[model samples]
Target: MERRSHIYGVMGEFATPEQLTHAVEKVREAGYRRLDAYAPFPVEGLSQALGLKRNLVPLITLLGGLAGGVGGFGFQYWVAAITYPMNIGGRPLNSWPAFIPVTFELTILGASLAAVFGMLALNKLPQPHHPVFNVHRFSHASADRFFLCIEARDPKFHLADTARLLQSLHAHHVSEVSDD
Candidate 1:
């Protein structure tokens, strides 16, 4: 196994959603721009508190749809009229009407594919390992607990200072999370 230095980060475990929300707000106001929050369920205003902007899901879908439309139409046009022209019923090889169905199908197919794949890529899915998981208490986060983990890699992070900040935010416990 390849061994690497452990990267430690401050983590604030909150017992309640309200504490998590309030902690998030204070963390932001404290100028720690790289903090994150976790809860059993979505917490209102948490995104705003973390200064997260709107996602690019819509933009990705739009571009994917455009590419699919153009690709489907272009491919069909080429195969039917240019590459291997097939003429039936004396209807021109470039029969756009015949291509409509495939083109439409491809447009929808591409948009759906992009929405799923793009979201996964953007969110960095398939991460089998994460430093937060190192915290034994973190499993509870998926249940009734709420958590906020600020990575040590954050520009403003200083081991002691970050932990102190988390404590000041009234977290139940501010533990150091290590990427092992």
Candidate 2:
């Protein structure tokens, strides 16, 4: 068996979302950037309280769509105009209007794919485990409880002071989380 010695962070269990939100706000105000919140359901305004910035998934999706559109049109144009050209019935080989459907379909496909993959990548999904799971109380996070955690890696994170702050914020329980 491997001996675990590293501390991941300190976690506070709250009875309500409001308390959890307040704790996050206060922790942020105290200059702790490495913090996260969890609740059984979505908590309104929690993202703002955490001071999270806008994500880049939209831009990524747009770029993917544009690339797909250009690629689709270029490929069609190359095939019709250069690769296997046939001027049938006095009609032009490079028909821009004819490629609209395939281009549009490819654009939608690219955007949808980019949105899915980009969101997963940005959120770092597929993780088998996280250090917070070490706290047995965290299981309630998927139920009725709310939680706030301040990582030890934060510059302003002092274990004693952070625990005291959480206690002052009306946490039901405060515990240390070990990164085993």
Candidate 3:
């Protein structure tokens, strides 16, 4: 079949989370990988059904925190020992204990900022529009409806076969999403 360039994918709206989850599992079993589900609230075990991997936010946060801590401590050491060395009461110029509080605060700050930014970046936030919004019924996704979309970009996606699969899974409505 000839692929349509303007077609985003085929979307199936389901009545409940259960049906959506089941459809997702069935679609995955049928070898379709590029698919997404939407619901008003979080659905348990939906990630596993979608075959999602572990999140990378924690690792990003750790790296940010380490950078902040190291940078803070290094700055303090540079000022105290190299840039402006002070010898007061025969005390050493490099004071490690005095830098602990600032280092700790900077670490916390960096970790929180990293988490916020990482989450936004990973989720692709600030998106004012998406191809799914072109469907009139998709507005219900924020209310009570659940939806599953099989993207046209998926290697196994064929408009007719995907629509049939969604219909066979007892979808309330199946429609084609347009990229335009």
Ranking by TM-score: 3, 2, 1
**Model 2 over residues 42-147: C-alpha lDDT tens digits?**
9999999999888899999999899888988999999999999998998989889999999999999888899999999998997879999999999999999999
Give me the runs in candidate 3 sitting further than 4 Å from their true place.
none
Model 1 residue runs over 4 Å out of place are: 1-7
Local accuracy of candidate 3 as per-residue lDDT tens digits, 71-151: 989999999999999989989888799989999999998888899999999999989999999999999999999999999
Which candidate, 1 or 3, has the higher TM-score? 3
In terms of TM-score, which candidate is strongest?
Answer: 3
Instruction: Estimate candidate 2's RMSD in Å.
Output: 3.4
Writing each residue's lDDT as its tens digit, candidate 1 over 1-180 gives 112247657788999888888888888787777777889998888888788899999899988898899999999999999999866879898889989999999999888899999999998998899888999999999999999987766778787787888888888878988878
Model 3: lowest-lDDT 10 consecutive positions? 1-10
